[model samples]
Target chain A: MLEIINPSMVSLIQSIIIILSGLVILIASIGILTFDKDMPNIVYVRIHVLGMIDVAGIVVFLALGQYMFAVMYLVLAPFLAHAMANAYFYGEDDYNTLYADDMVEDKYAALNAPDKLDDDAVEDESGEDADSAEGNADETASENLDSGDESND
Target chain B: MEILLISEYFLLVALVIFLISSMRVISYKSVAMGLIGTSSLTLAVTIILVVAGTVLGLGFFKDIALALLLLGVVGTIGFAMVLRRQD
Candidate 1:
């Protein structure tokens, strides 16, 4: 036989837990917001780790029905906070963008010799001219349709 | 019945506020302002839970659930501290 627990006792425990979850999420939000972009990659990883914790807190609170709705909010709060930090502070393409461009150049160099690359550029220039001709034909067709409409009117 | 309906209405409002605040927190350039917005959202959610708890009786699920929520809060604070120190 299993021992029975009092329902009131459970409520008290749940309330306490809910309050704790809220405080943690608040701290995480503050941490992520205050984190400077100049910090090392290790810092970003740590922030993400905390974000994962926040997610866990939300899921647990969601399960508790006493303040289930309340728990849901606690869970969502960190996700929102962390997500914002990611988009605003961490999203700047400054260093990464330059690095990405360098990577692209390296790849392009690897794929073709410098002379061959110049040949490809000339080919593209010709291709663009062809495309412009095609575009002109499309514009002419649209103009003809407009003229037909004017004639009907 | 009226209490339940009222709670539901308030819950909806709170949910909308939560969404708006979240968006503002993310988009705002000021880190401090974003934190304030997030705190406001936390408060709103807490109110929501209290209102919902009043409507729905406390039970076993509630206790376990609240404990988990507390853990999340703890985790958030830990991560925040880690991040703050990194900065």
Candidate 2:
């Protein structure tokens, strides 16, 4: 059977496989970047699925090239997938915290109040404890007002 | 020669994806997406190198390609772990 297959023809077939797999990787990258916002778990799974396609393409290309070390890559691919999945799911809480911080910053900026600057500083120092920062800001603002009244009198 | 040309085209496609993925600036999602694009780009490059090696009758390039594939996998997993820990 090996003798029957023309070497040039085999080379051509391998080249085609490589090209096709490269295209798959390209398409999957696009999908991963442009995917619409949806369920977190679903999105996470979809990205990993695309990643698997990429790994499949790499394995195919390496195997067609007759590289024996392809097995090492194949073995490591799953662990990479698992790591990405864990980053997505297990890190949800951190994402939520980041989102909340962004909201507070936006709100604080829009108010355009000078006293909020102190609160912003406090928030930065304490890291994500906005309520306490707000209380401190209120106290400082009142203190400033009282001092202003005394100086004016 | 024909294989080399086709592989070059594959490299071009992968480069385009890498550029697009790099331009993403939103969030950790972008980081993950960039990692995928980078790995794909590495794979495409490896394919080109392998074809070149075959044409030149050199066995060394194939070993380099295999090494690159291993690095791509390891780098991706490391980035994912860092993202997970930082988050």
Clashes of each: 13, 0
Model 2 steric clash pairs: none
Segments of candidate 2 deviating more than 4 angstroms? A1-3, A37-39, A42-46, A63-66, A93-153, B1-8, B11-19, B22-67, B82-87
What is the per-residue lDDT of model 2 for residues A32-128, given as tens digits with 9 covering 90 to 100? 5666545554435555655656565555556465645566666766786777666655455456557878899988786887788788776554433
Which ten residues in a row are the worst by lDDT in model 1 chain A? A84-93
TM-score of A-chain in each prediction?
A: 0.43, 0.49
Per-model RMSD to reference: 16.5, 15.4
Q: Which numbered prediction scores highest in TM-score against the true structure?
A: 2
Error of 2 at A2 (Å): 5.5
Model 2 chain B: lowest-lDDT 10 consecutive positions = B19-28
Taken over the whole model, the C-alpha lDDT of each candidate is 0.49, 0.62
Q: Which candidate is the best by lDDT?
A: 2
Per-model chain B TM-scores are: 0.50, 0.64
Evaluate candidate 2 and give its CAPRI docking class based on DockQ: acceptable
- Residue-wise lDDT of candidate 1 within B17-77, one digit each (tens)? 4445455554656443344355444444544454455456545534444555455445545
Once model 1 is optimally superposed onto the true structure by TM-score, how far is the C-alpha of residue A22 displaced, in angstroms? Answer: 2.8
